[model samples]
Target: MKQINIFSIIAAFIGLPVLFSSCEDVLDKKPLDLIAEDDVWMDASLAQANIYGMYENLNYFSHWNGDPITYRSGGEGYYGWDYYNSYNSDCQADLYWGHWLSGRGKDDTGWTPSTDFGWDAFSLIRKTNIAINHLTSEESRNSIGVSVANDMLGQVYLLKAAFYFMQARKYGGWVIVDEVLDDIGAVAGSDESAAQKLKLPRATLQETYDYTIDLCEKAANLLNTDAPSGQINKGSAYALLSEIALHGAAYLSYYDGINVDAYYQKVIKSVEELDALKKYSLVSGAEEYKNMFSDYAYAQTCPENILVSQMNESYGYRDAPYSHINRLLVNFGTALLNNNINQSFQSLDKGYSMTNAGAQIQPDPQMVEKAYYVIDLDRKARRFEESQLFAENIDIVMEEDRWVPGAMREKRKLKPTSSYTSISDLMYSRRDQRLAGTFVYDGSEFLGNTIYFRTGGNIHRDSYVDKAREMGSMTGILYSKRVPQYREIVGNLNCTNPIFRLGRCYLNVAEAYLSLSTPNEAKAKEYINKTRVQHGGLPALTTETGGELKMIYLDERVAELNMENDRYLTLLRTALSWGVTDPTTGYPTGEKGGIIPELNRGNNPTKKLEIEVPGDYMVEEDFMKPNAYFYREIQVPQSDHNFIFTPKKRYLLPVPQSELIENENLWQNKNWE
Candidate 1:
């Protein structure tokens, strides 16, 4: 799901205030002047430009804003709320953090500040409609226009279906806006109809789901992946239809608190279609994977890549952890690479190493814990739980005034001038191999010289690079993936963003298969082994995922989609009674009791946390110890009121509150207070 983030809007709105004009009307202008949809959609390429804009806006959302790792990575993102004292990893913390009152009335949480990603989704729907309305003008639709309009319109619906589905999942109760809002005009004061029109109430989850699915089917008939990338083709449309059904079913199943057979059927049907599509196949090769993400993939696209985001050096504003440098800063110079301490950020505050590590998102243990249970028969050779998720083992102890992993190699290898770190090279050690692919670990050969972190290099954290003297065994992990790949080192015309690849299809099929209950171990094994064979690893690695095939879903997903913005969705897939507790209400309208309320259910030990930060650093919501209200709270009560949206609703996002107010037919999500 491509989405826009606050960063873009920030850039958009930044230059507005600087201008000082009286009545020039210069500022009151459209981004593209004179060329409105009236003339644009009439042409094929211009219509495509609009689509490109939509794509640009959505990429950020997919990569960062809506990205799971952005929240759960290293407990830096929202996923690791427990890492932050004020909030915990529990879903309740999210609701509390996004409190109704706090989120209401123009505030960012509700609508005022509006999420860029959220807007991108709705805007995409609106933009697509504009394309349709233009194409279906009385003139066009009247003269053999039905076919053309239907084709384009089908694509729009497919895109919109995707839009609404995302909304339903995020906001639960969403407002349905079938068309664009040309203008808000003026807000009518509190009259009965005015009040109703001004504040769109949430639509029933059922309505949102029904509408999205309907649109998907309508689009499915028109789209074919073989169609040019610019248009929604058959492959894109059908795959999306399948995606909506599968995701919709999952969302409904969890939120409705009913394991409806209908939802399962939806998934099965879509899976069937996905199986029928013949345009995709997974790509293999470290270089191939790397190049697959570049523009170079077009000619050599893996059979797996069905839909890919249009990427280039510029012509669009957007941006990954495929960082080789930041990984260095994190590992603090372990393995063969020395720490990449930005001397500029170096401040000798006594002995504390304090530099606001650029927005590091960490994963919450609770969610990571669940991934272990999503059994997959494909990749894992060992049975495990979240307990198996090997996070960088940070051991900040008072002993020896250091956090050292008592291993002789670790202790002897510790950089003499260093500060804190894990006994095991958490950031760069043996873990998801994706780490190696996405990061530049110390000692790993790169360039003509050793690129790993070193003790006394400019990359070190020393206040002054020249003064930095010691050089011990380097063990830092720096990621430079999304970093601008300069043209001097890499040519641009050959780069492409690895948008929609085939790996996900395998997972989608596996998940659907698991949901079927009678998962064929042999079939599951076949899929898992096939994926591994691509990586040149044993085909039956996931034998340990589960004695049966149900356990391998999450593991296989992790192996394939790690840090690819799927982690959060993976958790949301298990969309638990996910909400905040109101001391006043037993469990709100729809939510489950959580945190201190017997959070884990059984022998499952309650979650605990111990974050390591610089001595003077205070715990923030995304970087705190476990036990904050959410971590310490109890499970949400399981009841009707506890649920907000239906499973179908999970697939779509609620329409923005402001938009609903302007549209008479639109309404808000029912979950609204």
Candidate 2:
């Protein structure tokens, strides 16, 4: 495997005008200073630089910490940023109140096709077409070696398909533009021949899927089997194929002339092909699973990463100081782990027990309640013990008009306190290990600091006097998933953002199996249990079948790939699976359900547990008192953040108004028009 400094190459090619402009703009005015089209094909280094530019273009559209879809999926919250502050995907989904309050929905008068919902990646697609045209030419193959040309060609095909897939999943179908209309001449022509040449009608949703799949297959055939991580390879193509096939199986079969079972079979086949390569595996053990997203994993060549967007400090690709992930999630305290999602992880000791109907039975709520009380008592006892140690060992000092714990004084070393034993630990530690790996609650340790999200505690929203500083977790939880633990400062934090992995591929297979016309329960369970046992450190699932199995599978996806997966798409597809109907047409809208109805409307009310703090902190006798307790077991009134899913056809995005005006042949998505 050969490692390419792709970011460095991208930096060098950053000044290219063709990569940044629209198709019309690119053709209308050719910059004299830029590299000539003919010269790019003749020189291998310049051609590779063009390809690297395409990869950099992907970052603008790819799902990462900064992507709106990350917040839209209800996987994580976004705060501090002016646009999405204190909002998540649930706002659009009607799971919360932000969309209505902010006037930002599809039906809002201010809504425009130019917004985030519009399709704008055609420029990237056109760039790929240019690359593909030149790379595939016989003259270029003679100039650049045949092997290098083929590899570059394979990457462009994948890139073009990926750009289309991103749009297809959001907008259903896009206009097919495979050829470079180089001979169309300047757009300033009075005849308007070049402008008319570009105005192609949109392809159907089914056709879009077919086009994406065909390109992925071609990429798989041409891509290197052992390409390094972050680079597109055979595995990348197969993984993408599996994803598109699964989505097509779920959504396209409803309206398009496609068989659901056939699409499912396609998903299975793609996964099987990728699996046969034996190129990647799920990172094993609890710590390894957590480290899979850290710099440690990036340095050690994490087996889980199939395709990644590599950000390196050495290449000047560091995260922005003000808006880095750690600042958003921890320092400025913008994003929080959703409370409902935090409570969804299954207990590690528990295995599914079969009911009389052959469905798996879950743990009783009453038993869970009793366990919570028992854990609460233990937590209080531990806190008292820790408070005594802190009082005896550490000194209290006045810092900036506030009483704070002083750093280690002289000979007395501060003992590690039991601050780690909050209700979160009792609730989470014994459950799926992935929960702790993904979220930091009241007592969780992060970056060598004890995080306290409880009311009146350090990281709580109420602790800040300045309104601008009140950006802590509203849900009493913060996301730790893919957040590096080694770096205290995040301005220059370098890490790989995973795009595809084997764990997700396994889930894709499980979903396809469970979704088959004749649902393969046994096969689905086997695939689900692989992640459950290995990544989650949970017992192997047994006897879960039918609707129960489907429920378990959905839960598994949330636990294993919540932040990473396109969860909004998953929810939409699942709604279709459950026979949710379209509101306007009253049709059984497959994979497009739940978006246009007041369905799955729920709230994520902020919860604050009342903990009784002893007065006169310097008094040792206060800790020695008989009734000195830590938690009062009283919960504050829940904050109202209820959901209201607007009834509109927002399943597919509208074609950009600007694009539609420019190309009159183009049509808007069904509901948008």
Which of the numbered candidates is closest to the native, going by highest lDDT? 2
Candidate 2, 397-431: lDDT as tens digits? 32221222453222222224434323333333445
Model 2 C-alpha lDDT versus the unseen true structure: 0.54
Tens-place lDDT per residue, model 1, 244-293, is 55565665665565554465456556645655775566666444444444
Instruction: Please state the error at residue 432 of candidate 1 in Å.
Output: 6.2
Regions of candidate 1 where Cα sits further than 4 Å from its true position = 1-41, 67-124, 136-138, 141-148, 179-201, 229-231, 294-300, 314-380, 383-435, 446-449, 453-475, 480-496, 517-526, 541-551, 575-673
Lowest lDDT block of 10, candidate 1: 99-108
Model 2 TM-score is: 0.73
Candidate 2 clashes between residue pairs 3 or more apart in a chain or in different chains: 71-89, 72-89, 94-645
Candidate 2: 10-residue stretch with minimal lDDT: 354-363
lDDT of 1 at 403: 27
